[model samples]
Target: MNPLFAFDDAQCRSLAEAHGTPCFAYSGAVAEAQFRALREVLPSRVRLAYAVKANPHPKLLAHFASLGASFDCASIGELERVETLGLPPGRTFFAGPGKREAELRKALALGVRVQAEGFEDLARLEALAAGALAVNLRVHPAFDIDEGNRIIGGSGPSAFGVDEEDVPELLRRAASLRHVRIRGLHVFAASNQRDASKLIAIHGAVLDLAKRLHEAHGLVFEQIDLGGGLGVPYAPEESPLDLAALGRGLSGLLARHAWFTGELILEPGRFLAGPCGVYLARVMRIKESRGTRFAILEGGINHLIRPLLTGEPFPVKAVGRGEGTIPYTLAGPLCTSLDRLGEVALPDLRVGDLLAFGTTGAYGLNEGMTHFLSHPVPPEAWVD
Candidate 1:
């Protein structure tokens, strides 16, 4: 099997035949390999928590859990999904901006660490907890963030976390809380970034911010979570993130910031899960309009919406057909004109020809409009 596709032509054809087209198939081997690859390079002080929002497949979650992985859950549903794993306390975390009281209760019941988004969370947790409780403060920093991507929303006015400048006041208010205590700092300001240096720089900025808070407020952090932004290549031309360099840089950061003896956490969802899965869809028909060759697929944004949302297509290959220069505008079966996956070069595509999209294991099915158009949701086959 080619690393790009996760499955070879024969395997892809077999998966398509077994599960039917317009479906997702994940390789547990790929998932483990990705985890081991990243984990082996990271510093021992760095903790790896798999972000459950990437792909919440039960098998996927359990598989990561089996590898001694912690989970970063974003919603009550995700918390429930991680709950099914029966992990020990401190192995799971709940994070989101709008957390319901029930959700906070669930987190409390599960003994999962909560990444509180703002003062509301602190107040809510204070009311919910029976005794002293520790949580991480998810901060929206105002400096040195990658502003190009859509996921993290960069340093601009964002809804994800508490603003950095306002954290002091929030902390002042939080000190009056009876139970909830801030023990960690979380900063997620980048998304799908490939450069190791850039990621390290952002992380460095976060540490600097932590240092400022610790000095000014006499705050002590038990953990500094560098939230999930580690990237995986979406294209053949793109280079995978250099994990070795990343580990070295983090090790250096930890050594330099000796005053902060707390653990550093990396919650990577896409970086860990994206390369382990593939989406298989068949060409329903080919239409040639004025200037474009359209290959309409049985699935599109309804199954995989990253290309439509990010304008970046997954690396695709026409199984059983060799590569060619014919450009194809890959569109889904949706009625809207906006249901385009991507326009890429491929061999002559025919009806029933299977198109395999690689690096789709994470955000593929989980982030799509599967219920739209009343199309039958495709089955996701987990190949262990």
Candidate 2:
């Protein structure tokens, strides 16, 4: 835990009392700190585009914008948020697999940088740009980016990028399109990877490809967009991310690409905002049977949604009128057994006590539901 509750104990308690159970609390300081740490590591040559899908709430986006960070949008709605926040199109990069033509048209109109996933997207973008937009090629690298098949792509097959063998033809096609400028290249491997070595390997591959492309086509890439899958420590014993290593690796790669003419781009989502927020749920019931204890929280898969769906483990801490330490099974009040957050060892959990779950910041709120008996949703509080 980042001592999230330590910052504003009274306010957190008040918010819980007023807003009822199943609320969210986010720390502005943590968010800003993460960005600052990233700035320290990111090469001076690259432009940082914070991926908005991690936490798209307007206030958070505005905070990132104020820090001079750019935006990476996945959909038209996200693009509109960028525009509405008053961030210029040049500062935002539009990237998503299977983007609709409407979204591409919006991106083109906004004059933002775009990433084309395949040959067809290139065709669609060229047609839509009508002589006005440029895009990077999103390449699916040859690696086991994901440990399992849960994510968008992995080793065997993926639908998110052009094949390595097809690069020349894709470039040839881009060369023909007068309106669409092929400005760069991109590779997004996976999310929540703990080992920094894996990231280094992945970036090494990206740079190797860039070097080959430069040699073959007389193409000097202005920008190399590396999609972010930076993971935050969700387990209590895990160490914080080694961003310094990532920075050194990335900087070295860009240094080798002296032929590249434009800025370097990084689209990081989880690293920027995932650990900044904590989910607060009220214990509705506590039961023990056959040497097992369960602290059933008021909210289920409906409010804090990702755990049940992805099996990603998050840490849970007992708060508000609890003892020092105890082992208990933490579960949501939902009927489905899988609605359980996980088996957690917390300090003396009791009915009606508040339980704070760590690292719920990335996918928790946005992926939550209002389904199953239509339980009222909780309020979100921003903390300093």
Candidate 3:
């Protein structure tokens, strides 16, 4: 079986028969394998925090928690999901550009570290904290970010963190806050990047930025979060990230930066979850409009929206069908013409043919427009 697809034809058929069409199925074995693959290669000082935004499935959360994984949460719902694990403090981190006071309070109550985006976050956290609090300042670096998709909004104007140029002034203003202290630095400058060397270059730049901040402001960091962007192959032609190379680069960085003794943090979401899921939907009908042949599935963007957002479709195959030279434009059952999965080559597909989409464990259903058109939401099965 291709690593891109979590299940073989037999497993896909079985899952479709058990869960019905237009549903999702995740393999716990595959998810754990991915986590272990990355974890084994990482340095001892590197903390692996599974980004909860990827897939907050309770079973998935519990599985990762059992492996002693930390969690990276961005919303109250994610925090709540992680809370159900009842893990000890310092195993969770809360981060967002616009965190509400209620969310901050919840984070504090649960002993979650806050990734402060700017002075507003610091001020809000200070107001909410009864005693002293420490946070990691999220800075939007001025360096060029090499991302194929503009998911993080690049190095230009962004709504995510404090701009690199404005950090000095923000730090000056934050000095007066009595209850909140910036004890760490956070910089997320990559997205879905696969090259280990490129990711290392980006991480090195972030560390250099941290060193400059420390030298200039006399700040001491307990942690430096190199935010998530660790990528996974969406298609077979694309290669998976080089875990060994990534580990070596990080270890080298730690050795070089002896002045900073804090542990490095990697919040990986897609790389850890993408390969374990398979979205199975049967073809509703076939349409040959103009020169294009469309295989309209029972579900569309409502269930899987990453194709529309990233212009990159998840790897898919017609279950029980052999390979062919025939081309197909995969479409969903949505009302709009924009509801497309992707254009691909597959065996001759017919109505009721089951199509299994691979690499959807992360940013699959949860990121879709579930409330659109009143379509029935697809059920997700956890295959243990």
Candidate 4:
């Protein structure tokens, strides 16, 4: 069975039959294996913080927590989810562009580290912090970011972190803040990048940027967060990221940058969660419009919208159906014409034939427009 598809045809059929069509099934074993695979390759100084935006399934969170994984939370909801894990302080991080006061308060109460995106974040956090607090300053580097798909929106303009050029001014103003101290740096400049060499290049640039900040601004960093863009294969043809090479590159960076003794942080969402899931939906009907062959599934962008947003389809297969030369345009039950999963070549699909989408564990139902059509929400089965 292909590694991309967490469940085989037999398993897919079982999951569809057990959980009903248009539902999702995730393999706990696969998730653990993926975490261990990356963890084993990483240097001891590197910290793996599982990004909660990927899949906030309670069971998944608990499982990761049991494996001694730290969490990277973006919103109050994510923070709350991680809070339920009952982990100690310093294990959870709160990071977002526009954090509300309530969220900041909650983060402070929980002792979660905040990734301050701008001077405003620093000010807000300073006011909320009781005593001394350390935060990692998220920097939008001026360097060009090579992305296959525009997820983070490259270096030109973004609403995420403070721009690299404006860092000095921000720091100058932030020095006035009494409670909030910038002790670390965070740079996220890659998206869905599979090439290990390319990832290393981006990481190297971030470290170089950090070095400049340390030397020029006198900023001492205890942690440098290289934001998550770790890529996973969505198709069989695409190569998986070389974990060994990535590990070696990071180790090499540490060796080169001997001045920095702080731990490197990697927040991986999709890479850690994407491979462990399979979205199962049965073909509701088959339609041939003009020259396009359409296989309308029980679900569409409502359950998995990554394809619609990224123009890249998740690897899908017809359950129990062998490979074929027939082409298919997978559609959903939505009213809009834009509710397309992808156009791909699959075996001859029939009505009620089960279709399983692979690599959907991350941005599957959690990221979908489930409330759009008032359709019954699909149940997600966590397979052990």
Better model by TM-score, 2 or 4?
Answer: 4
Compare candidates 1 and 2 on TM-score and give the better one.
1
Candidates' C-alpha lDDT: 0.91, 0.77, 0.93, 0.92
TM-score of each: 0.98, 0.91, 0.99, 0.99
Tens digit of per-residue lDDT, candidate 3, span 7-82: 9999999998898888999999999999999999999999999999999999999999999899999999999999
Which runs in model 4 stand beyond 4 Å of their true positions? none
lDDT digits (tens) for residues 1-384 of candidate 2: 244232344555776777666888777888898889988888788788999888887778888899999999999999998888776668988888789989988887787888889888888877776665667888887765544525655655777788777788888877777677766898887777767777777777787888888899876687888788777777757776788888888777767767666777877887888878877888888899799888888887777777777776566666655435566777787777777777766777657888777667677777776677677776777765
Order of models, best lDDT first: 3, 4, 1, 2
lDDT tens readout by residue for model 4, 92-187? 988899999999999999989999999889999888888999999999989856786989988888998999999999989998988888999999
lDDT of 2: 0.77
Residue 120 error, candidate 3, Å: 0.8
What's model 3's lDDT at 14?
A: 90
Clashing pairs in 3: none
Candidate 1 to truth, TM:
0.98
lDDT of 3: 0.93
Report the lDDT of model 3 for residue 151.
88
